[model samples]
Target: MHPGGIKTELGRHTDPVAEAQMIRTINQRNAAAGLPPFRYKTVPQGAATSVWAAVVADGDVVGRRYCEDCHVAQIAGDPEVRGGVQPYALDPDRADALWELSEAMVGERFDPLN
Candidate 1:
């Protein structure tokens, strides 16, 4: 997780060096757990917008499930919401803002059926 509980994909003022260090830590933990290491990449500007647009087009239920799977238990929170099981990113207003920004950036309308 990036500093201040921000998602990496959001490209929110992340320090590249710090992010690389965090990725190393994550890989170390994964190795200890016998899990495959995750590949890390510096997210490019607007990439999150494109991805968010696609997710929004996929429908809220699907998007929610995706968020839960990817961010759940990863974001900071109390015991009941540990590991992002209930990510703040999934909040409706935030989701809406993401979708809007995505559309504005990409110049595409989200088609739920697409």
Candidate 2:
């Protein structure tokens, strides 16, 4: 699902040829933006499970995991907005509260991986 709450449907089978083409397209755009091309890797289920268990043990929460909920709340506030969702124009008080909460949760630096 996209951050905008749009659901994307994918084919059931893995298509390596199509995936490679998509990666090439992504690399072209990344190169145009002076960014490094992404490296793709396939890992076994056991490896992936161990990695996820380690991450959870480290107390790291993926912020984007909650993006759907946030977007739902944002869109629920206005259904007829031109951009499909209202801009998150928080007032000064709300902004300050958010800042304080963030600081308390993750300190000054917003590093979820650390």
Candidate 3:
């Protein structure tokens, strides 16, 4: 949870130090919950892109800011470029699946199976 939200604060006026702190907070929460720490790679709204890097503990990559449903769609053949730069709470099933996956991925890297 970036304090200012990824979409809300991006671009030249953005604050890297603040964003890093926010990412650290998110990582701490995830670690405490036995989940993977996601290092935000890029945030793009409309067309612009911004990259964020974090020290991935245990080589893990997380989908913290992506819709699990869309992530599933992207994994499947939905013909839609689904993954996005924000977290979404769609339903119980999706949420459960994400939690399970996150737990399974603790201290491990996440390579999308596509």
- Top-scoring candidate (lDDT): 1
RMSD of each: 9.7, 14.9, 16.5
Alpha-carbon shift of residue 97 in model 3 (angstroms): 30
Ranking by lDDT: 1, 2, 3
User: Total backbone clashes of model 1?
Assistant: 6
> What is the lDDT for 85 in model 3?
34
Each prediction's TM-score versus the true structure: 0.34, 0.30, 0.31
As for model 1, its CA RMSD to the true structure in angstroms is: 9.7
- Per-residue alpha-carbon lDDT of model 3 for 41-64, expressed as tens digits? 334522222122132212133333
State the lDDT of candidate 1 residue by residue for 13-58, as single tens digits.
Answer: 7898998887787777767666666553334422543454455445
TM-score of 2: 0.30
lDDT minimum window of 10 residues, candidate 2: 64-73
TM-score of 3: 0.31
Of models 2 and 3, which has the larger TM-score? 3
Score candidate 1 by TM-score against the native: 0.34
**Candidate 3 off by > 4 Å:** 1-9, 41-114
How badly does each model clash, as a count of residue pairs?
6, 0, 1
In candidate 3, residue 81 scores what lDDT?
A: 21
> Candidate 2 has which clashing residue pairs, if any?
none
